[model samples]
Target: MSLSPMTSVVVAASLAIASGAADAADYRNNPFTLTYDGAITQNLPGRVNIHPVTYKLNGLDISANVYTPPNYDPKKTYAAIVIAHPNGGVKEQTAGLYAQRLAEQGYITLAADAAYQGASGGLPRYVDKPSNRVEDIHGMADYISSYAGVDKARLGLLGICGGGGYSLKAAQTDKRFKAVATLSMFNSGRVRRNGFMDSQLSSVQARLQQASEARAQEAAGGKVLYANDVVLTDEQIAKLPFEMYRQGFEYYGKTHMHPNASAKYTLSSLLDLMSFDATNQIELINQPLLMIAGSKADSLYMSEDAFSKATGTKDKELFKIDGATHIETYWLPKYVNTAVAKLTQFYARTL
Candidate 1:
């Protein structure tokens, strides 16, 4: 395995133990147990709390959480946004946080667990194909556009981290979304093929061979191989490189982990991920666009590249959160608040 990915395994294992090992199911009921300061723990006095829901997507059952606005009246129309979770995330993590916050702003929001991952129903679980992930975003929009009290014409979309990349790809063809926004977008294709910052360029052919072999094994009725599932010590995790990987382990693998989210994907997924590029046709997004990233985030390049290539949208802007890294923007209040404020304004104006 590449050092960039192997080191991340060390970080996840170490932090999972450090965050107080327990039954993963026990963490779901109270998602805010390790949430950032001021995180809403229950339904706001007048707002609707998360409504655990299930919908059909491509013949599979997809689980999701819908947060309705305060004093929500089904008879009155309201804007809606479909929020997609990060690659290793679920509806109960950062995606849920942003969904709830957007609901508070009077927009009905839906965050769903992608098909084949999290609580969704799919065979050979944890497949991470770009086509499937992008379809998941389109499915979210389809489900939310017809939801009670939603104004289909004013629908919007928000994607974080890996989801941000998928969201861009989805919005490229799904023009139903009036506005599109992404936070700390991480191009899964670029990194999966070239390695983080292209560090694994030399090993591309070798890794592709590995992935092909894995796919063949699965096709032969063999057990599925997984990636990003490793065990390590706290001391080891602390010494790993990359703040995003380090702190990300703490967020998803540790404090905020959910039972349905294991942070691992089928090793064979590398085949599709390596071949897909979210920015390949980004100019198709003619709707208003807002891409936000932390100034210090190493993943900022993906967002910048996507923003520069988005020639179809004249009303596009790139905002940066000063001094914040990618993972820090996931839960840290200072940066989360800034992102939410900008998103609120952007959606209000465009959607």
Candidate 2:
């Protein structure tokens, strides 16, 4: 039964529409679905278990996954770690993977969705306000301290990508986090203001111009549009200046794509990011700090720059994973293992 090309196109379009509707319904009801590729179940020993938990923080119901260590006793308090996800990422992404792995290593780990994103609550979804995001970290620490089986005094923090920057900001004021670590930490403010590697310094005025237009549109009752770096086709992806952008899509857009994950962010809120600087208060942090970044990453300079600006002495360490790119450290075994090992040692020593 050979159909005409137009007929084939119509059939394909119909199927896509139906599939999209079904997905939308599922998302509206459940918000998230865990795709068990047996990565965790098969690899983790039978003793460890990951539990999905929800708690309220700052008038919002926050969703997170908590991994309990094997042979856990309620009477015995255990050290805990709070894992924050990358920008445009939910808890179930790399954060969840790291949390599960750390739980297998005998530490209780909690991976949380940032406010206004993923399963967490906020109005005008996907707003990436720096202060609110930093508060989310502190909120997670509060949740950890309230747990009966968790020791509040031995709390540690781990953040990936933008979350890494937020973790550093949180640790500045929240001394409850005895140790802090970041994986491929991104200084969102620096990149927003000066661009990655400072290559877009001259384009700052242009970006501000675009943002002003976006604001004008919003004022005129227009829905805000988002500009995402995700490239769908080879031609579109070829336009990326570096290989890391293409690699990031592989990790976040394809292999581990979540229905709740969004590629775009509100254009108007971008101005907030440009003005937000997390590194300004690094001098206030007195806890042990670990900053992990890939030497080959285009974003590596941000982490290095932050580490240099941090006034914390004696306990701060910067580890560069040789030959790895920024996005490669997200889920790659070699990079993930290196990060887990470094983080485990850092927390073990400090907490």
Candidate 3:
């Protein structure tokens, strides 16, 4: 639970439950379990079905989950949305929760893992390049737009945490997305360059030096060195600096644990992340935009800053969930419901 920004493989930790999700004993050793609360337990009678899928993105296999509504009819076209997981997350966690919920609301949804992370195929696992992550979003849009029962012209986009930030960038030019929404968006570049809350401004040069050396080592065929690569004890987890990072451990490392989910990215990734900004040309997103974040979230500034730069969208809004922290908006029942409610309304009206 180090808030070092490396553990940014974050998610809404799944809708924070189905009946058996409240009891850990039911799934303690179940490898097939989705690991997140309210996970699909045998595809309920009237619920959506999650179809695990894979497609090529920049010559790599990208893993994804496609959610289709109950009694889905392929003959009839339907609106769709692409849900992007946080930087350190996969399709089965928060991204899946939102996709399933949206599908329940009559929209086909696709959630995919960025290449090199989760179950996706890529070299040097966890590279986390900005261009690659953005390409993942475009790839999702490409696949989902052509999916059965989906209307190519009525597609929407949603990203949670780090994915949120990337979605803004993608929607800027990918006019296929008629509407764009983000929940707890995390600005990967801003945090990487300026540090958490800009607390490490003075040490930026030193960190860059470290990253450069790490790249040199990699070039020399040395073992990969990762940032925030530490195993924490229970007490140590309890002592983490931010609630977002602390609760992230409880979600990804314990309750919502999945074999493919991880927070570690290559140290070389900083070179690209530090230079990329999701809002660099945000004004290009002329589509309807909605940015949601917990009012009490420490990462609220990222959402606010991005929202402010989106002047191109006349139909834009910044909504905050009062009293909820950054991570709470991920899985807390009330918070998740609030976010899903807003998203449903936004997509319904726009798409």
Clashing pairs in 3: 9-88, 17-38, 18-38
Residue 344 Cα positional deviation in candidate 1, in Å, after optimal superposition: 0.5
Which numbered prediction scores highest in lDDT against the true structure? 1
Clashing residue pair totals per candidate (backbone < 3 A): 0, 0, 3
**Models ranked on lDDT:** 1, 3, 2
Q: What C-alpha lDDT values do all the predictions have?
A: 0.81, 0.73, 0.80
Ranking by TM-score: 1, 3, 2
True-structure lDDT of candidate 2: 0.73
Tell me model 3's lDDT, rounded to 2 decimals: 0.80
RMSD of each: 3.2, 8.1, 4.1
Candidate 2, pairs of clashing residues: none
Put down candidate 2 lDDT per residue, 84-183, tens digits, no spaces.
8887788877788788778877788899888888888887677777888899999889887877589998998998888999898999989899989999
What overall lDDT, based on C-alpha atoms, would model 1 receive against the true structure? 0.81
- Candidate with top TM-score is 1
Native-structure RMSD, model 2 = 8.1
Evaluation by TM-score, superior candidate among 2 and 3: 3
RMSD of 1: 3.2
